[model samples]
Target: MDSTKEKIFRCAIDLFNDKGVSHVTLRDIAEKVGISIGNLAYHFKNKDYIIAEAFGRMEEEKMNILSGVQQIPSFENINNQVEPLLNISKKYRFFFLDTVQILKSYPAIKHKHQAYVENSIRYVKAVLDYSVGSGNMSPEPEDDKGLYWRVATTAWMHLYFWPAEVAIRGKSDPDIGEVKKMMWGVIKPYLTEKGIHNFETIKKEMYASA
Candidate 1:
């Protein structure tokens, strides 16, 4: 990306995070970037274009995090991914902060987000099943209700809305370490004795490294 375009995006995202996206104008981004609206237009055409690019970059970073888990899923491997996921959410705070309005206003972006969400849910379910097969997680009851689906969906809900939740509660933004602890709680109940042992061991190392 051109340096100017990069600056425009950085400024736009910052403004969007500070002010709601609907309230931010192209001029606001241009002024923040220290460039005239004309110069900003030369690179981005409009605020919509900048929004698309910002989401594209966010999607790329998130995909990289998902791809990092190449090995069969385990408690340790899943734990490794929590921090990166939280980092992505922090970097794109505006997206989660205004998720409903953005999805309503941008049909194309909404479609893309839906596709990404499907993949994410599938990934979580896959990890749960893999862990069960490997003896790290306990199996669901014999009735085999949608326990896994519910767990996966609930975890996704927490991750997607955590920033907004904090804001609504009038709380400060949490560090990744705090976010990781809460996220682990989402799946902690499913862990078997062996999994709990591994999780306890890994938690110490993860926090110590922090």
Candidate 2:
């Protein structure tokens, strides 16, 4: 995309994240980009289009982050992944929250949101399968393995929603790390003895490097 269109999308994302789609006007986004409303409209026909494009951009960035991890992540690599996830949460928390809050107000967008959720589940499952195949995780029965994927994806989505509360409060919640640990607990029961040992070693290595 051209720089001008990129600037408009960035500005719109910021405004949507802060004030929400319903609360923000096209003029607000234009003012943010130091462009006339006409110029902004030249790139996007309407606010809905802009909102869709903003989310599309977010999805692109998410795919890039995931794709860059060339192998099953150890705890050290986990930290690198966490940084991008946290950055995304900080940047777009409000937009995500607002999208959920106004689901009834935009049925088309809501449908798209549902599709994205399903796609995310699939993407996460693929990653988990890759990790298990590479011996990062324990082998399990097919049924139980599917359940693990579901659990992980569900936990991840819940975590994404959490950042919205933090964004609204303008402070990091002290319990956030604990929440992450609890989510990890979902897979704890499924780990083999060797997997458990490896996980502990990985955690120790992660802490030592920290």
Candidate 3:
């Protein structure tokens, strides 16, 4: 069962994603949740408080998806991660669409956002390392510190822009499932034959599960 605070948090994400952060206020969230202003204030005193909680909820959802993965992650494992993350990203589209403005408005968000960025980099590095360990990738320079950072940084750049790209080109909101497919291009060049084989397997699994 959701507590009043949890309901408010979810309601705020919907409101913010629909009307955008800049256009939303505490009263709007309170009204959407069918709670009085005083009741809402009893939980989240301000808009920033609700926004931060919403971001925390995203992190928690990601953690739940990852928790089901194998110990030594693989290309297959990464597919498990990316698809759900994309869904969550699309669900909270306003956060990405208006990210810059939110950051500028609430400078404190940068700290938590940086944490998410670093976590993503770490996951990318782990996948690379696991590939080399499993003989699915070249044992040479691919896992070297410089190369690892370069690839992860570039990969994250693509993932980060998924929604921003849609907004920038004034493109129709493509289906999230198809948008997730574009991630394959991000890391495809570096993959070995074995890596590609494993990735294809994961792709099939994603299709079956979908």
Candidate 4:
């Protein structure tokens, strides 16, 4: 990306995070980038174009984070996943916070976002499968093949909306620690004794490293 274009992209993200996406205009982004609207347009045709580019980068960023997951699941690996994932959400706060509006307003973005979300849910299910196969997590109960799918969907829901939930409550955005706790809470019931032990060990290491 050109340096100037990158500046405009970054400035737009920050403004969208500060003001809701619907509240921001191309002019706002241009001013924030210290460039004129015409120059900004030269880089991005319009707000929708900028949003499309932003989501494209977001997909790439998320893929990088998911690619770090190990073949064998462990609490430490889960920690590695959750922390950066939450950081991404924070960095692109408006995406989660204004998801409904964005989807409604941009048909192209909505289709892309839905596809990305399905891939993400599959990633979560894969982690669960690895954890179960490794004896860290219990098998899904009651012969329910859909158990993993439902759990993965629920986890994605929390991951997608937790930031928005916090913001709507007028609370300061949560740190990774808080978000991690909520994530673990979602999966904790399915953890085996070994899983619990691994979690505790990782918790100690995480704090020590911090």
Best of the candidates, lDDT: 4
Clashes of 1: 0
Cα RMSD for candidates in order: 2.3, 3.4, 3.1, 2.3
The residue-by-residue lDDT of candidate 4 on 1-210, one tens digit each, is 559988988899999999988999998998888889999999998989888988998889987777667453566876778767877888888889889999999999999998999998888889888989988889998878788788878887777777888888888866666666667778888989988888897677655654
Instruction: Pull out the clashing pairs in model 3.
Output: none
Q: Is candidate 1 or candidate 2 better by lDDT?
A: 1
TM-score, per-candidate, Cα-based:
0.89, 0.78, 0.82, 0.90
Instruction: Kindly list the per-residue Cα lDDT of model 3 for residues 83-175, writing each as its tens digit.
Output: 677777787888888878887888788788878778767767676677777877665573464776677677766666787787778876645
On the 0 to 100 scale, the lDDT of residue 74 in model 1 is 61
Error of 3 at 126 (Å): 0.9
The best candidate by TM-score is 4
Encode model 1's per-residue lDDT on 12-110: one tens digit a residue. 988998898999998888888888999999999887787888888888887676666535476677677877787788888999889889989888899
Among all windows of 10 consecutive residues in model 4, the one with the lowest summed lDDT is: 66-75
| TM-score quality measure for candidate 4 | 0.90
lDDT measured at residue 162 in model 3 versus the true structure, 0 to 100? 81
Residue range with the least summed lDDT across 10 consecutive positions in model 2:
70-79
